[model samples]
Target chain A: MPLWDALSNAMRMTRKRRIGPDQAERLLATGHDPAHPELDRLLAAATAPPRPHELAGLDAALAAFEEAGRTRRPAPARQRWRVLRPLAAAAATAAVLVGGVAVAAEIGYLPGTDRPAAHEQLGSRAAPPSTAESGHGTASAPAGTVEPTHSLPVTPGGTAIERLCRGWDDRRHKGRPMKPDDLRELAAAAGGEDRIAAFCAPRLRPPGNGQAPPNSPPSATHPSPTLADDGDDDDQGEDGDEQAAARNKKKKKEDE
Target chain B: MDDEELAGALADAVRGDSAAFASLWRAQQPALLRYLRVIVGESAEDVASETWLQTARALRGFTGTPTGFRVWLFTIARNRAIDERRKARRRPEEPRDLTERELPGSHPDVANEVIQRSETDWALSVIATLPKDQAEAVTLRVVAGLDVAQTAQVLGKRPGAVRIAAMRGLRRLAEHDEVRARRAESMPPIDLQSPRTEGV
Candidate 1:
């Protein structure tokens, strides 16, 4: 069979111990295969240098690679923001919880508002000396300082809802409805005080647009807050005279 | 590039300097393209482009000397060629006409015609006829000018395996009548129409 002949030929080829690559290369350079001199011709032919034309298209290829590299260099900053935005939002939510919610909201530090615009509105009146004015000092100041120009952290609605629910908890404990405020308005929009918790839960877990409830009218200070109109004089009702004076100062600025 | 120039360019390239990258590309692209041609045939240009693009993107992160860069570049190119082959297998294209066969001793003046056919083309054609592993071994060793260890690194094989493959491939090329016919001045001319003992 042809298989037997092939096996015999392979055996014969192997019988003359196979030429090492190094030895073959050496023979190739010399232009003579010591064992099979005839093969020297083939080795010499195969070893000929490639033509200059072989290097064609190289310049254009490198140009294309450089073009791609230029475009890809700026991508890391955008990628980093994609990872950090949510962590910032979560940190803001946790920070709002520790600070007194009613005082924070009364100073126009409520959530569901454009942060920079709210900071802009709050900027006109000097920030209150009270360290418990946590909403403006802790939440808005850092965001303003870090990314003062970029309109990135527009999701103050979660903070607004947290402030509202805290107010609802206070009203339930005191057995009295605190004078009409943003929390009261948000609760009313949710249909009742009982529904305030449910209403705030989804808003706290902000969706993509970061807007408050669609039906709630935009407030004077923050374009997104639906409860701006309800909390006008409630600062005095909740925090007595001094906080009310500060709220009056804020209201004057919003009106102007 | 000499080792000093290559090392400096490699260091600059790792720092994302485009000029350094271009210098490295100019020095290495010829061999890389030739090696790709041997393996991927017509699509070598596209595959080489993909390989360089990936290399450029990852240039900043690579940490090695110039010689290591060659191994890494070829490894990426070989992987890309393998992927192209697999894709081609899945969606088969119309077969090209292969009717024009080169008969042994067909040329009247063998030595002249051998010189006319550039060695790269002739050698690649012979290599294409070889088994895949042997062809890769020979192309990486001879065309790419990689040492045994570097060729083994590129091929993802043991150095011994790479050596054996290159040895077998060179032996086969030596035995091939077409290759031997090119060195007509040193040996008696072969008659393709008749069979005779392969006289050394």
Candidate 2:
């Protein structure tokens, strides 16, 4: 048994020594090893070109790619919404302010003080007489009579004009017809059928412009206009008229 | 694909282009599969599929050069292979000897048949016989074409350790009886004075 152990130990000592780490690193990096050609053959075999079955999963992989692409497509849109949300919130606030002013004008709360001054400004501009006449007629009437006659027409008349402007814009873009009653009310407010376009042009221009017709009292143009609209129009004037129009529409809905 | 083409494809793939991503898969899949084969044995294909799926899912957000992309892909594959191995250890299925695995059936195309029966299979089987650390170090460094630093990163080892493991693995393969036999069969008798011939 001791002789057998000695022979095994001798065999172990004669076995090949391990290659240097640097040499192994070089072999792996460059795939060349003159000292060990067998290792070269082994690496060459290990890195053989893919078999047909190896790529059998390509179709499934690609399907996963497409599904991922589909899921990722919405990320940009979400990012866009991240940017647009604040602007939408501000616009919504402006809409509420505009709606409040429209309602104030309808209730005669604003027209009592602001409408006379607006009429005076329009009177100097030599605006449509029907609008100036109505304002002068209401201001000249007794205060007791003013609330009953003045408030009634101003309420429905203000709403009718706003409705007509929205309907007109929609009709131009969508080919929808206006309600006949709204058209007649708008005609009466303008004092002539032909003057409706001339009357609506300034009103449709975004609120707080001070150019709205005298009959609507231009409450958005009032010196003490709703603070939010005043602030938003100042801040967002460069955002363009389309956004302002949308804000105005939103205000009208909120007021209603 | 060349680096220039790979860069272009990577950019396009990040923008959700399937064709560009396909080119990437075709280029990297072979190396990835072979590396996984050495790391995970019979579960290599399943692990590879999981790797590609994960790569596809993250492709849109991935930003890197071609080399970095390859590293990222291999890192993901290695992590998934580790997970598979952990699960395999828990379940402990029946062990089938490597030689007992089914051989490729006969094919009509001679070249295809030869390829199926090539030394690659034998070499891979031999590599799979290595100790786990040495096999992984060799496979990542040689089969996956990673540098020592990269192999160390994949194996969570220091670069020095990886180099040693790889060296030891190569030395073991060099002394393998089958490897020596094949070398003898391929070459004519040489001078006995050669250092490698001293033992014999």
- In terms of DockQ, which candidate is strongest? 2
lDDT tens digits by residue: candidate 1, A1-256: 9999898667545535556666766542343455555454444434444334444565665675566566556456335434654564454455456666545444533454322333222321221222224436647555334423322233344334444554555565577775676544554444333345444444332233254443332232232223234343221111122232344334432110
Best by lDDT: 2
Residue pairs with clashing backbones, model 1: A111-A156, A111-A160, A112-A156, A112-A157
Residue A88 lDDT, candidate 2, scale 0-100 = 49
List native contact recovery per candidate, as a fraction of 1.
Answer: 0.19, 0.53
What i-RMS does every model get?
A: 24.0, 19.3
DockQ of each: 0.10, 0.20
DockQ category of candidate 2: incorrect
Candidate 1's DockQ is: 0.10
**Predicted candidate 1, C-alpha RMSD:** 22.7
Cα lDDT tens digits, model 2, B1-200, are 66777788989998888899998888778778777877787788888888888889888888887767777788778767766776787775857343344355454665664544355666777887888778877877777777777676656566777788888888888888877776667643222111010100
Candidate 2 per-residue lDDT over residues A39-93, each given as its tens digit: 6666666766666655678898999999877655435533543465556456545
Model 2 Cα shift for residue A122 (angstroms): 50
TM-scores (chain A) of the candidates:
0.25, 0.28
